[model samples]
Target chain A: MTYVSPPPEARSRGWYKRNEIAVTPFLFLIPAVLFFAIYVIIPIGQSFWISFHEWDGLGDKTWVGTANYERLLFDDRKFTTSFWNNIKWLVLYLLAIPGGLFIALFLNQTVTGIRLYKSLFFFPFVISQVVVGLVFSWFYLPREGLLNAILAVFGAGPVNILGDPSTATYGIIAAGLWPQTAYCMILYLTGLNAVDPEQVEAARLDGAKGWRMLWYVILPQLRPATFIAFVVTIIGALRSFDLISVMTNGGPFGSTRVLSFYMFEESLSEFGFRMGYGAAIAVVLFFIMLGFIVYFLWSMWRDEKGAR
Target chain B: MQSIFKASVAALALGAVAAPAFAESHTLSGDLRIISDMSNPAPRAVMEGLAADFGAMHPELNVELTIVDREAWKTQIRNALGANPPDVVNWYAANRMAPYVSAGLFEDITDMYENGDLTGLDSVKGALTIDGRQWGVPYTYYQWGVYYREDIFNELGLTEPTTFDEEIANCQVILDSGRKCYTIGTKFLWTAGGWFDYMNMRTNGFDFHMQLARGEVEWTDPRVRETFANWRKLIDMGAFIDDHQSYSWQEALNFMIDGEAAAYLMGNFAVAPLREAGLSDDQIDFYQFPMIADVPQGEDAPTDTFHIPSGAENKEAARAFLQFVTSPDVQTEINSGDGLGQLPVNANSGVDADEFLEQGFEMLTTNAEGGVAQFFDRDFPAEMASVGMEGLQEFMVFPDNLDDILERLEDARQRIYE
Candidate 1:
């Protein structure tokens, strides 16, 4: 740090003037730091604290030690089902990345009305997730859905996609993917624009083409976009609450409950008042997310060092 | 013209509210904040009217009415009451209030009840009281029963069933006639809870039904099984509409409207919407759910109530507001055909002359010999009800899974009650 000598006007201002340069940046940082501590850091700490209690949200919180966590891990079938559903969501949701890349590649063309085609493909992301859930809810309707309508033309089903426990989770994920894939496609489209055509041409001259060209040259350049897509997808899968809430309400007998939705159902929803259990669920979800967060920070750090 | 008519109605209602207030010995002169859950079009009007008239009665008192959506208020009430508590709030009766009452969020209004300040409320006082002390006052309640197609019944030459055999015979006839006997949607799941309330009550009588609700009885108790056995008979007969799990209670009404189903076991609120949906009074009629055994005939009548938070700033005004709202005249006016179109909790108040309301009032007053129960979800603890309703829905869909469902509920009951 550089030492700043007191100016003539500040010479008689004591230690305050002597330390102005050193303290000015901290004064500027206080607002953001305060907000972050209050909103994010403090709540994370509070969640961990609350998890060890038996609170019904209205009453005084009773410290139950690790009982909430024990019940959540061992005895609660709903939690088990929700955890498995989260796994299903995580694995299935990653399909969007590849799906987006293919669509981005297909749309990376010089044709008439290509922009129109791209926008049409990008249309789902423009609308809200709630709308997507509703449209897909009707699409999977047992008797009068578009899915059944199309299937009937081929002498097949009247399948109740959202009604059956076995297929309801898949149906919701498919709806979520509609918009999520669009998001990834846009990310990749921007990445493809800055994809360094000179490198692509150089690879083509070396006889690299098609899938090989994509793997060796295109994908390497789209690393930033892929990185963003992977992180967002993971977070989206972990926080898969809204679509499930809007569509099934974690139902046909709690078959579609993920951890985020389950936490809400156990704490704040009409029947839920077990706040300690909910906080325990939240703490578990936070730890799960923390693993990815640490990985992201480490990767960023490595990348920064490489740049240096 | 519409605005003019609305103004006249408002003036008339406000006039009624104002007349009694002039008799109050002292004037209230502080901000009285209220959080109401009467967010429906008709109920919202009644709430706003109540707040306005209260403000009018106490000219110096600033009355604030914040109307939250009825469903959202269920979860929001705890936060609302636990924090900067309002002077008054809307909530449901029975175990639905247990959380707030036990948490000391609600004011104990027992002295008001004992002092004879709220007259003719003793009949529903049982609902407002927990541990021998009154906590709140009920403004309105509605009866739940089989709302059948009178036109269909007449066409098929069938009478309202009065016993288990007769009900089964009637349902078989309806099914044979190429229509379902009942339309129910377990999508939101409480509609199924209503069915369970009636079935369990009628089979084992109200006391045992209440014991089951209180978690004192096992889900696998043979007597509880007896109730399910009766429920299973109907399921096995395909007596309910197909894909009932997909529709909501409101959506299920389409079956009756289209003559695809013959009846719906629902609350009195369904009457208003049925009329709105183009079903005339002649097309629909009410009947209590038929007897499944020789038990006293219990009925499901869920009461909606109001309470003052414990930390209310203007409690004097809040107590006066509760008394004013539950007054016989006010109850009669608010529960009129033009208002909530339901039964008034003030026993002295006459119900609206609406046909369905009259029938429901009669049924709940004289015919409910076993007891009047707050519907299942309201009677049982909230956690148990949530898990229980889901199991009930699953049971309706898969009758063979009864053992598994019962085991799950028994486990939940043990854990929750402990």
Candidate 2:
């Protein structure tokens, strides 16, 4: 192979001059940066500050000095329930990733109208969560809903999907899973597009098949998609508020309250804004989220070092 | 160059001087966004008429009224106040205003109140006042009562019950006739609490209700237990609808509107919805809950009030609007806005409507005469309402667990008070 060097004029130039970058990129970045700071960063910092004080969002903020944190630890049952529910949500929600992968694989073939089938499978994720909550609520309605109607065919009585304390949260989580699983499927489909056909053929020749082949070969290649799916699912589980609000409003005796709903209930709902208490709940949630973020960053750093 | 500099300096001085004066002399000329949960025709008509009247009174201010559904309004009010609060907005009385007042989020209307700028000041000023400072004015007053169907009662040969037992007997008669006695929705859960509040108030009077609301009285207090016992009797008799847990208040109203349900124990605000469905006043009647008849008199019956946001740009204009609303003429105009026939805040305004409103007016005035107390939600605080509503709902469904429910409510109260 022959190698050619750059012209002397190009080689002579410094890094800044060679780039010739315009201000347009900075212009494009400005709006996004501004939005991020305004909506995300500032509110986060404000919530953290609020966690330290007793505020109702209206009155003079009393300097509570971690009193809220203390109360959340010892006094607030809703906080404990909300935190535990979030954990349940995170653990069960991850099932969507694998469920989505299976569906994607099954529908990956280039058959007639496979695209339409894929889209149809993805339709739940396309709708807003509010609509999904309404649909699921109707589906789970005690006597008149689809689930009950189906149960009636089997000669079973109506199930109180949203009324019973034990099953209400689980039912809502199931509703959440429907859309989340579809989202994971989309991610896997994209990842499968770039899979090496040659490698798969060689693996098949070597007698690797089904679960074993998938575990060793295809799964490893799909790690990036899986990672993204896990990350979003975790965040979704932690911030699960809208669906719970729409589906049940933490009802049937606060059985469905997640951390986000609990926080809002304390600070904003008919429950007078104990902003400090709400912030304390937020602080606890923040630490939990931070653990995952730190682990993710550390893993990335370790991978970079290994590559070097 | 000297002349040019002088001219520029003079123009700058004139601009500075003219700006505030221009702002002051102008009538409410810009957008007056009024955010309310008053979506029904009666309040909406009144609100629209107020805009027209205000426009006629002062042409500069253009009122832009935006009515949100009840739940949506709470979220909107918080966001709006946190960012850009409207000039005039709707709010509840007492502790509801306390949060906003303490934070300096509302304009102080003490000056206007003291100056007699708002007529009928004695009637509504209390609702808007916190710690002696006036915050907002009430456009209308409402009474909580049992709205029953006169046609059904007459058809069944029943008179309005005078005592708690009589009320129970009345329900029994309706039930024996294979009719559902009462309608309620526990879907949002608070609707159940309203029933509990009325029962407790009637059984133990305002002081006990206040004590319970404040968490001073245990939910299992004998008085409180009595309220539950009373509720249990009704529940045992199947007084309420079968599937109330799944119904919203509006959905329950559908039962009354269609004559499927005989009675609704609800606030006076409910009348407009019933009337809108083409039900005549002759078909509907109101009465105080029979529970309170045995108890001693209490302070002022609770009232819903509104406030001026602190960050409002048109503070003076808002003050003027509040004053105008409380005036006798405007109060009458507001009452007649859409046949809402709400009890006027002005004690002197007196009821001049058909019999339903007249009876409501008489009850409210008698309450005013007796004295007033903040409603349970307002008196106790928000945290209390949360656990309280839950306990009420639980008790409604599981009367056997009254002790456990009351104990939980007490625990919630203890934490909140601490």
Candidate 3:
């Protein structure tokens, strides 16, 4: 049947006009927009405003421009230590990306009940951070804990893993990696599923095996998964608080104190509610996070532009 | 389409009807939220029972309770007190309450005192009173003392040490027996400070501690130095647990219970855990730390009280709850628990009334009679406590820098006062 095309204005008036279809997506997104505005956008703005003032959570707030920041920069030892430790955490925590890929490749076989083994490996990640901290702390207990018990069997002297300042932060970080590596492994496993079988067979035919296969063929295919794993690991390391709280409470002379725990300690702890000072610490932390976030976003943007 | 729209409208109407019913109850509407600093399950059970009783009595007031950890509790109380404090909640005594009271954060229960709603508040009245007006009602108070395992003492055939020399001898005996003399944890680090407080209280008395708290005396004063010297003597005699940096209060208790350690220099709160371990009252005993020959006596007890926040929603209800808590009946119930054998603030309530509280009462009352000092943290401002705790931790970890440590503390004190 021959049909005449309607004019633009008439099409706009029609039910399934371009304008109607275009507006439909935004209509469906109203609830999400409202939620994001209420919970995320507003709070970030409020926190930034509060960062500039000297206000306890309750009483009258006094405007003190840049004083909190000054204290955070020059006065607060806890803040400095925590920030430096966060740097260490970020650097060390990214090790999980490669480690996860290694484990995923090892366990990605189509053997019988390999699924059960994968789930079991992922079990630590499934448990709460609080439980992981508790389990690790008990494991590291010097006198009667599982670690000490194991050491005793070997006739080795007991190590106070959590108590010793040298090992405490690293010990907690190791516990964090237990779940983090599992998470990365799951991401890689999904990425591995979409790998080109024909290319793998061709590579095998060309005598590319093991390390050569992984470096030239497999890892390149898992680029998206690796990036996600690295991003999450970095964020997890920077924001580690629960395990430290549960395990050490920044004890043994505040040696294990991190930015998040230190911020909490400074603001609302028995040390006194120096809320302004706390905000300054938070601002420093936010900037540090912003730096990482900006780099990641810039890289993504560059990749998108290059693709176009 | 019409039928679906009608059903949707009916469902929306029903949801609107149900929303108000969720909040509107025959039972009390708002939860009578009580934020306690006591997070341990031992006291939690007692508080829960008390809450249940309180709820049953006043059906209109629903009591929802939470026990915040100590550090969080302090911060939360500070935050809550300024704008929207709990109607009633726990607070520390004396110097600790001064800042809150000065800020007008706590409600004055002066009426309770005048009307005789609080009968024996006059006795421990100094505890909750800020600026000569009552800000809180005392719930529990306990003396700081050496909590020794009577079993260990019996095993070594040694008696409780009454004098400084004898205390050293007791440590000597324990060391001779191949067991450590004391069980302590410097991991959380405050347990070490308890020793310093008690020693300072015994060596220097209340006036000296008050001076220290006020930033009047140098932290490097000879009196403070002498207290450290005494602590060093115990250290020299090998009177403390090995690897003390590895444990918390409960972990230290485990050492004492297991017979790896002889004594735990702690407050009466230690009794509850010992009791929980099935150790009878006779298995554990308390004694004041030995006196330095020249130092005047000072009280070394800590007191916990309830203060009304400045912006309490239910002022009358909060006041009534505070008054009720300090009443003899409720105080007696608190003392009945092994975890809270803290002396009752109401002196007239008498120790003989509650079998459990009698021992703690005798200790606190005796210290009060002898002119003892307040516990260290209670006597000092929060700023000072922070520095003092750090100093104590440093002293334990590095005993040789006694002079340097004192100087550092003095610097901290100067900074805080400034």
Evaluate every candidate with DockQ and list the scores: 0.74, 0.33, 0.33
Q: Could you tell me every candidate's TM-score relative to the true structure?
A: 0.94, 0.84, 0.85
RMSD of each: 3.7, 9.9, 11.0
| Candidate 1 chain A, run of 10 with poorest lDDT | A5-14
Best by lDDT: 1
lDDT by residue (tens digit), candidate 1, B212-284: 9888999989999999999999999999998888888898998999999999999999998889999999999
Best by TM-score: 1
Q: Report every candidate's CA lDDT.
A: 0.90, 0.76, 0.76
- Which docking band does candidate 1 fall into? medium
lDDT of 1 by residue, A166-279 (tens): 888999999999999999999999999998989988998999998899898999999999999998998888878889988999999899999999999998898997889999
Candidate 3 clash total?
Answer: 5
Model 1 Cα displacement at B272 (Å)? 1.1
Report the alpha-carbon TM-score of model 3 versus the true structure.
Answer: 0.85
Cα lDDT of model 3 by residue, A164-259, tens digit: 767888889888989999999999999999999999999999999989999999999999898889889988998799999888888666778898
Give the Å shift of residue B159 in candidate 2: 3.3
